[model samples]
Target: MASQPLDPGNSGRNDPALLRLPSTVRHRIYLFLGVARWDGCPLLFDLDGPVSPSDQVTFYGLLLSCRAVYTEVSALLFSSNRFVIHYRNKRSLQPLRNLTPPSLAALTSLKVVLNQASCHHRREAEASGACCTRVSGCFTRKPKGAGGHCLIRRPHKNLHDTPLQSSDPSARLMLEEWRATAVYLSSNTKLDALELSLVCDVDQKEVEAAEHVVAPLLLFPKLKDCHVRLCISPNSHLRQLARNASRQASSNPALEPASPTSGSSRLLITLPREVRIRILEYTDLVAPLKEVMWNRLGLGYHYFSSGCSAWEGVPCLPPYHHGCQYRDCHGQGIIKDGIVRSDQLRSIGCFCGVRHAAFSSTCKCWAPPTPLFLICWDLCEDARFVFFSANRFVVSDSLVSANPWLAYDVSFTPDPKWLLENRSNYSWMEWYRQAQPPRAYPAHRFAATKFLREVVPADYLGYLRFLELVFPPYNHECWPHDGHPALQDWIDTVDWVKDKINAPAITLRLVMAGSRMWHPACPDDRGGLTRVQGIAVLTGYNRILKPLAVLREHGLTRFYADFAWPWKWTNRVYERLRAADDPNTILSWLEGQETLLNDRAERLILGEDQHDRLRSNEAKPGPSPWKMHSGREY
Candidate 1:
């Protein structure tokens, strides 16, 4: 084969030159490269780890090697819109002072991921080599992490050394340096999107530093996009999510520009169609999803907890009519609206308020509607190639070349087809069929249908396409999570779906403690499903007739009923419904017989018991006989 071309466009596989190509050709080249990624922009560099000053300079120099290559690569590298920076040593902070151009201009999106694990371990020991036995009093001690990461020790703010201690002179100096460089980058760089991951080993202050230092610059500029990922690790407190949120500058008139994050529709509903689809794909993002992962070994119906565990105990909420209002129980609140605490033995609800809603807990009562609820607040128009939570599907195309302007196709549809395609990647059988006996925790599963309906009207193609665009965190074009927990949930719900109902599964369910109460369940259980005494369906004007039906004729009951407690364990509330009503009084509700049936009942079954009364006196034949003797002799 010809030296496989790294340069995308042109004749077969040949080592394409990195320099001196006509601008049009290069642009077109990128456009036609590998399965149409961002219109063929292939400068994807996964530099999501610790960076030495050398690494930063190297990446910068490598991109700026020659103006021709530099022009194309510079934007892609910085346009990444996401970044992670792990500082192994305090000295590593020096790179922020040397950010190059184009990269700086296109650096609208940024995410700084840090390792906050074991970030507080400290010891009282002197640097042996630096210490003189003759003068023990003069030598101060140095701290070390098992992996060689050092912690600056101090006394004022903490008894045990922590990265938060302001007493350490060196730590304070490092903090100051971070602010200085961040200010400089802000003064010079123009970024649209930004994210920061706070791993263990780093203090909330590190994240606070980014908010204080970086936000002033990035948030002020007239930009279009802004993203921030506040990742809290195991050894770290989760308070930082709220802390960073507090740094939001919605009214800073000095820097407040009219754009997405600035109180205006940042990623507008009318973003390019591609972006719209992407939004749908990633609308359900849940980072730090390990706790929410119910099953990731590819074998069974996994239970997701922690970050991705939004539906835990969420009741069977319909897609339309009802708006979402997550309320915590007595002490533990519903973990919706971006709350992640599956391990704390709490409860959840997944109830909703609409007919034809993809999911429904009770269609008895009517509730106000809201936008399609997304755990992650920021969503974009690229639902096809990103997963807000996790990918249920992963498709790879080899046709993508590089072209910043070229357009590509990504799927972010709420259409069942897209959902099915998104689901094909999972092994639902892992624990699906073999799952232990159904156990009800004190959680409730409400419907999200009302929410979906509020956000998406019944405009068919328009709504479906809209879902594709508004949803973010999906990967239909390229790059998807290897083992997507959300995708796993999708498969579990789908596979468990009785093939006969082929009706789209409406409710999203999550696992939690047995004592906790979700919506229908109690709302005050911090100990999960175990705390709830019982669950009651909401009586809404909504009712389930048939998933497939005309708009008006659908059987809707508007079910809504609050519980009185002291009854019922954790079993599905839907099973309690015996029938729509008495089967004998069918004729009273039906008109002169050719009724447009839009429910789950068969006509023959309903009519069988009813007396057709005063029928034409034709002698009826006997019922068809059993064919026991028709086969061979016994």
Candidate 2:
């Protein structure tokens, strides 16, 4: 069957009724025609294949109705759907490179999947002059080793027998093509999202080649979201690069004009208080405030090397016997025959632990509206309240370690000259070995109250309505001891929150490890468990939960605690406790079971509520309530 020609004569002239409709209605029709919407599915276009007959009629047919319609709707066709270009070989990317300037500029979302096998195939084809015979302009001239005919190709038992080389002409050509396409996309398009997937054999050279090919595409300036998947180990570097590009894109000044207050928008103050608050809600001010990890690299390095004792011959005299106030070194008795250390003993800086925080939401579709807070005093107050009260503020164990007073101790700064002169034989590692705390000591202690008291401002704390504290998994052995520092820390934290903060609802989460039952009867261990082990496990959990039960009287209207134990183990534990003979054990088991069931019910209810909210938002029409600075609608 033959396809109809685009822009057939007199088609639009005959359709007077369609031309009489409003421009907005016509645009809506064009959008529907260009990308038909099916529930819960994304619009995707594969440029690697030919256009389907249905698309030719419903999409291109509409465009060909008239020159005016084609001019108006062509851009929408590229912008509305996500185009997927699979680069299998050099010829695979021709469709993308052939896009006109107008089409490229309108492109907003793209996904590119790179395959390395095509390069190998091309190389093999070139070796035997198989591709040369297919070239239209090629002259039939036999070369030295041709035997008066194109060389016959031999099949390899293993396709990857010949490894791809960086200097190979086919590989170089493919990379050059990729770089050009990336440059064009970056320069011509203001993309909302870009996804790159590298599919290749898990070899070092192939991974390097894939990285070089995708390097330029990762720098799309106006992208709001960027996703990169490398089918190889050690992809963290590439992932970090993509993250940096996304951050730069969001912060790009060209994405939006100056603050709304810069112009006559100063008149916005005349709006009603309710209206102003509603407007501010649309901005990032209402987004959740998250505690982000700070000084990650420095802390990671220090943590991994904390036990290193490279600095030997370090001695403690008089007050220095207990070591420096910063606790960088612990004084060990002198050994006479050790070499003097050259490096100065320095304290880890104040920014070692978590010291910086930000208002960050999980949504990557839009950047936060930060300038709104700087507009005026009244607006700032409103924005702060909206931010604190409307969305939950999350605190974790890392935030608890951000005590600047403890971090910066000036009582003891090591004197380099004195240390070198009075050098001891003891190495720093030996001192660390002696000073290191017991393994039983908890690595992370629950300190939500301490974090709020030390880091958050009193004004912001009072405005908070919802607070979520994520604690590290409770250690049964460390937490059961009443005199332990970990136990004391937990008590002090909850006590302080009860005394000071007035958040209406508090959510406590403990991420736990999954447990497995070991069968004593079977030679090959399976799921069945002995009664004694089960009882011990349940008792340990009970002891861990006993202290947290105090949260019920913390004065909050609602308090929810989630012990994220696997359902299989939780049910097994409950059954084991139920079979026990003691009445006290039965009562405790009932209480724990009730809590678990209630948590499950609450989760289902919350999920349904979220679903309802989404449906309501969808029914309301217009753009999403969340304000997007990029001028793109979700």
Top lDDT hit: 2
Tens-digit per-residue lDDT, 1-634, candidate 1: 6543344353334434534355556655444442124532222222333223423323445454566566666665566333334344334445445566555666643323222222211111111111111111111123332344332222212222233333445545555655575566556554333322222223435554434333443334443332222222211222233223323421222321212343334445546765655555433322121111111112111111111223445432232102222211111322334443333321111111110111111112221111333212443323312332232111111111011011122222244664477576534332222223212211121112222323222322121211100011111121112233433332343233223221221111111111112212212211233322221111110111122122112221111111112122223322232343653343333322212221112222112222132013322222111111012111
TM-score each candidate: 0.30, 0.36
> Which runs in model 2 stand beyond 4 Å of their true positions?
1-261, 268-275, 287-377, 393-442, 447-451, 470-480, 503-557, 560-592, 596-634
Worst 10 residues of 2 by lDDT: 351-360
TM-score of 1: 0.30
Report the C-alpha lDDT of model 2 over 1-634, residue by residue, as the tens digit: 9744333342464654555566666667865665534331235566755344543335767666776666567676666555666565234588888877777777655656553221112221222212111111111121222122231133222222123456667667767777787787677765554333223322333546645754674556646544343322223344333334334545333222325755534666777778888887776565422212111111210111111122365542322221122111111111122222322211111111011111111112222355676788877777777766665544434321221101111123335774576478534333322332222434344445455555556666666665544433222222235456655666666556555556334433332222232111111121344455444434434434455445445543343444323233344555765677774675565557645743543333234454345345533222111111112210
Clashes of 2: 2
Local distance difference test scores for all models: 0.27, 0.41
Give candidate 1's root-mean-square deviation (CA, Å): 23.7
